[model samples]
Target: MTEEIEQFETVLGFQIPEPLRTVHNVHRWTRLGNSDEESIRSIIARYIEYRRAIGTDDLDLLRTFRNNGNVECIIQYLRQSIRPMVVNTLDNSVVLICQPGGTDFHALASLFTSRQLIMFYAMLGEYFFQQVITQEEISGRESGVTIVYDLENFKITDYLNPYSPIMQIFRIGIALLQEYYLELLRNLLVINSGPIVRVFLQLAKVILLPKAFEKIRIISSSNMKERLLELVSSAALPSAYGGCWTEVDVENVNPLTCCTIRRPIEGKAPPCNIEAAEHVNLSAGKSYSAKISATKGQTLRWIVKTSGKTEFAVTLYDSKGKGEAELLIPRLTIATPLPDKVPEVGSVECKDTGVYGLEFRNVNSSFFSLKIRYGWVLE
Candidate 1:
């Protein structure tokens, strides 16, 4: 592998980036039939060129994003709007499932330009890759992931139109995945496939590498559960896919919110540390507020679960009253707890020293009060 890496750099006329020089990645290249000098050189060259084109060549920048919690920040923002993609992990494989019908593409396009969305996707992919590699190091084994694409309700029109936002973003995302993470793909299971899915596969054949394309399997809804069980255990697979796992909220699915990290980095803070758990009775047409002092650079994390859907927001006020209070997280509707009892969780990094107000409002017209159990921590 060391000799192959040296030859790869010699052929490319420049040394590969430090992040791509990992033993796992070198083995991935070799496993993907890049052992020959010419093949290895060609694959590495294309990967480097793609990273440069996408402005993600600076792996250090991605590391910064991961360390500063920017990756989770972007994920939270996306979850509030659209949630077509959900990620989970099995024994040695990460599963990424996409449901095209779950997204509001028009709203997504209005919220973010194509470039912004593409960049976010790239960053998320990089984070996932990092996590997978870290797990490999810990387990002393190679790892890859499965992509389960559920096209049960996908609209062919939205995908076929060249000018559509969905089409534009989809094409770019596919290209990026193929160029950058093709070696990480164990197999792609297209479940609930139909005629439209077949058409899409035809298009994918053109975009995906021959070996990558061969990893795809189309499965109908009837036998999807049985077939998937062969690869993923009932404990790890979501119930929606014919498994026993029901922790994820399928109705309001978001990978960041639904999935738990298999192996959290040892030194970093957990996503949220609850310092207090208290209940509040919010009367109908009224609100409840909790205040906490936070300094700049500290992260404020909270989890709220109510008897019913409620309005929630966060505001930052000047500790000395020298300036007006700023709304950190705007008022948004928080859905009621799912059947699995997963609470809605959120966090934001403080940019100024101030008093942060976490407010919950009962918007229901009923005269009864809403019972809420909430927890928060500042770290």
Candidate 2:
């Protein structure tokens, strides 16, 4: 009995508790009895139906069976028709019977841990039972395991087949549910800044800004002289109008635009052409500004096209250091149409926070007049 119980445990991954083992031994003894096997089969069929009446479908459970009212009557009939025979099988052999008493039946449920894992198993078990009950064409011959076990002959004969239509339907239902939930979780993990921004802007339109345009807050502060140009000049491959407010993933190289509002330095005058030179040669420690009107979120870009061996350092601010702050000039260099590489964006921690501002430095030589053109974007 112990060996047989262990074999069942190996296959099911669960141990057969005490009283249940005793029931199994009794059932085995009855099977090997001298009377015809038909009587035993009839009792089993009646018990199965009684169990089905309540909520359970376990073929092994003979009493306290389903809540259905018919099981008690069946049990009474069995008691009268065939005396309850308890068999004692070989030491290592097993006999299937009904266990009337068991300690800690509820404790066995602990094997199922998480809610999600429990639901998964329940779905599979339900599918299996439903299939076996509904399918008509599935035959015992096609199913590998013989359904009924005949102890007298020590053989199992054809009884139930697992390939029924019921099982197939169950599988299909489970597959569909899995796919639906997986897709939902996938969408949640991916961040879509574009749509999120659009929704925010639309909501702001109705609540904050309405009827033409009123005084609004623009993040521009020149209070801090230290300038940091977050975005540098790069290939302006994107078309002017169509590319506004679009995002460029940091992992890749792309041109980002920024807007600068500037005024003349205390003593210095405006550049000569304002378009061609692309380079600025100003006295060290001087300040300058140009009239700027840019929507927030737009990137500002400066292209340098200067001749001679001179480097220019420029600073950008909102209102001469009074409002929100930004970094305009990240580094000092003579390179124009800035290289494809860009400094890391700003962050809250400091390493590379995306704020753009001005940088200060001296020029090696001086030029008569410098030309500058600036563009901004709201992305």
What is candidate 2's CA lDDT for residue 257?
A: 20
Instruction: Write one digit per residue (lDDT tens) for candidate 2, span 111-196.
Output: 21112122332332333223322221232111000011111211111111223222222233333333211111101101112223
Q: TM-score of every model?
A: 0.53, 0.17
Q: Highest TM-score: give the candidate number.
A: 1
Clashes of each: 0, 46
Write candidate 1's Cα lDDT for 1-379 as tens digits: 6787776567657787866776688777766555676677677776665455444555554246433343443343332212221234455765655555444554444344333445566665665576567657667667777667776666655655654544555566566666567788887888776668768787777667897899988886677789888877665566767766554454434433233222211221123346337889988888888988989999998877677656677888865576865666645444432312235566789888878988889977778789888788888
Alpha-carbon RMSD, each predicted model: 17.0, 39.3
Runs of candidate 1 exceeding 4 Å displacement: 1-19, 30-91, 246-379
Estimate candidate 1's alpha-carbon lDDT, on a 0 to 1 scale.
Answer: 0.62
* Model 2 stretches with alpha carbons more than 4 Å out: 1-287, 309-325, 337-362, 365-379
